[model samples]
Target: MKQSLLLITVVGLLLSSCSVSKSARGQRDLFSGTWSLDNISYENNSGNFKSVIFNDAEDICFEGSEWFFRDNNSTGRYTIAQSTLCNGGDRFFRWSVVEPSQNYSSQLQFKFIDENRKDISGGYGYRLNIVSLTEQAMTLKSNVSVDGQPVTIVYEFSKK
Candidate 1:
């Protein structure tokens, strides 16, 4: 009788524990890590989409670029490493999320804060909508205007 009661209690506890769900990175703190630029794709005004090709040799300078996110901080840095394509030494610029309250997985607003390069204003910002994100990879989409035409850009990155 005691064995039966013990077995029933154990089974009950196991069944009750099964409902606890694991939180994914998208729902919680998961963006604080180094990420590398994987690739970029863009859509033209006519609703046509195409991937940007790094056909030029100098374009490879950014192929090794990185974006580092600080833990619990909405600020980050865009790091351009020194390469043969670029000899300006290593360059780092301040960047931050315009609004950290919103979900980056849904819609993320980004702004460059380095005033020397360009004027930092509320008017200039980039919007990235996360398409996919995992511990290994993440992809985001940004709608941009080029030459008065709307374009949708998809940026793919890998965690480093």
Candidate 2:
């Protein structure tokens, strides 16, 4: 009876692990496509909004940018092509969806890389809360501090 119980417990643990892996894979598959940044909004709505985002470009530049995600390799690129004020170019990054924990929501994290797949952010990365995701749309929110007040930058995307 003891051996049977142990076997059953082990099998249950293995099956649960497999299901979690499958779920993560499925989420990545949904993100494996070209997406257009449709809109960007502020949740806290502070007048003292930061102009720069990701320390790379102006927040306005990302509104109409293009993002490409490859689920198989966990690689992606984002193109900034909208504003004359912003330098238009492609930025490469390796991305992953972090599974949700008791204290945090499901997060989308990425680190900047070069064309040769080398790290460029000096071991720094960005994490955004995965607010919502669907076949046609996804929304991500990044929390920031401006003048000692918390602010949320919301990014909206549509699959293309």
Candidate 3:
């Protein structure tokens, strides 16, 4: 009777541990939601801008205005493929998080896409930093070139 009780207790402990791990995975999925930009910080050739992000649990829709002349207003959508976030075609852009955290690091590669479908091959490449992420929001920073000048921009977003 004593040995049987010990085995039961060990199995119960293992089951509880497995449940805790499953809960953690569920927490990561909490990032699936809608969010909007709340603030921005600009430096160098970069100027402040704002936008609104609406995510439909799967894809993300973004409507924003930049500080650049002739390219201030923009809109786009991104989809999650595996662990990478992609926009447009394979030639457009993609991003991946290095670690998972509210204040984590990420790498982004800009695949230039044309502003108009007729000129889809005419664009430049760039990079961005995803500084943080949560179920309701995310913060990003990047140094980008406008014309011939490089500038740093910080963007903060919140759930809508």
Candidate 4:
């Protein structure tokens, strides 16, 4: 009886570990394919707006950007359309979904890379709180401080 109980416990533990990994993998799989940044809104009404986001591009430039994700290789790229105001181009990146824990929410993180897939940020990346994700839509939030007040930038994306 004792040996049987021990085996059962071991098996249960292994299964639980696999379950966690599977969930994370599933989330990544859902991110595969192309998505368009449809909308960007602010949570707090501070009457102040940020000109740039992620220190990469203007807030207006990200809207309508095309994002492509490859789950198998964990590689992706986003392209901003060229316009009179925006200097549009393609940006390569390595991305991952960070699993949630007791103290934190799930995060979407990505680091910019060059055309050759070389890290260009000197080991720096951006992490945004994944507010919601589904097969059709995903929302991410980035918290920042503006004038010593908390602000949240919400990014909404839809699969294409």
Candidate 5:
């Protein structure tokens, strides 16, 4: 009876280890894909604007693209940077997305830190916001202040 009990305990330990390993693998897969912005919405003094934003890869310079405003006919490029991922241009500017929680498998909150640019007011040096992530899609929601006023913008991206 004692030998049988020991064998059962060893098998249980191995199974538990396997389960943890599988979970880690799944989390890594979440960020390992190409993403493109699909939609965006925002409000300004004039009113509000909602439209679809497409990633024009041809215009991408250092992994960033120009955001087009369909209604007013305006455009702006938001640059992203990361230390290790940065190809060149500026050392302080690296392009990458940061996950809020360490556990990547669960709902992910992302922040696009643009160390190279300053906010509209010039008081804030960088842009920070929460992002939603899924297997094939990612959405960035910005509730950042510009010129002492609050502005919200949502950008959705999908896997290529």
Candidate 6:
């Protein structure tokens, strides 16, 4: 009876350990749902924070925007509402999370696609490092170039 009890305890310990690690990997699937932009900020060429005013096309496109991620698929939809400076519509894209590894950090990538799923956002694709991710919120950092100047954008989003 004592031998059987010891074996049971060891099996129980192994099962519990497996459960814990599997839940961590399950976090990758938690990205599904509609996310709304909470706010955005930028870092200038000098790597200093730069405030932005939303008044043009770029700004309007982000206003009232909603990102919808589907479970178990790399395709998603970006929805925006009509505004004075923008024509709101739905756009499809291919998105995936880069699994972090020993040699490199993880990031989120987006490749704009048409109805047929052809690449369109840019040939190279957009990559943003994930700053934080939780059940209710996510943050991403993107470095971009505008007019020969380097800039970094920080985006905070919350589930809707």
C-alpha lDDT score of every prediction, in listed order: 0.57, 0.89, 0.44, 0.89, 0.42, 0.72
TM-score of 5: 0.36
When 1 and 4 are scored with TM-score, the better candidate is 4
Residue range with the least summed lDDT across 10 consecutive positions in model 2: 17-26
RMSD of each: 12.2, 4.2, 13.6, 4.6, 13.2, 8.6
lDDT of 1 by residue, 1-160 (tens): 9999999999999997753223422422455688898776565656544333222224344555786765453566666666655643333233333323345545545555552544354446556676766777878777666667778766788989
Provide the lDDT at 69 for model 5.
Answer: 15
Task: Report the number of clashing residue pairs per model.
Answer: 0, 0, 1, 0, 5, 0
1-160, model 6: which lDDT tens digit per residue?
Answer: 9999999999999988655234334545767888997677776765544343222236436745898887566788877678776677877888877766685456777777888888875665667788788989988887777778878787888988
Q: Which ten residues in a row have the lowest lDDT in candidate 5?
A: 66-75
lDDT (Cα, tens digit) per residue for candidate 2, span 1-160: 9999999999999988755465667778888999999988888864745469899998888889999999877899999995668999999999998888897788889999999889999999999999888999999999987778778999999999
* lDDT tens digits, residue span 40-99, model 4: 888876574756877778889999999999998889999999988788999899999989
Prediction 4 TM-score vs. true: 0.85
Q: Which residues of candidate 2, in runs, are more than 4 Å off?
A: 1-20, 48-50
lDDT score for candidate 3 against the true structure: 0.44
State the lDDT of candidate 5 residue by residue for 1-160, as single tens digits: 9999999999999888655344434443554544555555564434553322222112123234322111121112333444453332321221223334563323322222234443333232233343555677766555645567776665666666
Off-target runs (Cα >4 Å) in candidate 1 are 1-28, 44-61, 82-105, 114-124
Model 1 clashing residue pairs (backbone)? none
- The parts of candidate 4 lying over 4 Å away from their true place are 1-20
State how far residue 112 of model 3 sits from its true place (Å). Answer: 8.0
| lDDT, model 6 | 0.72
lDDT value for model 1: 0.57
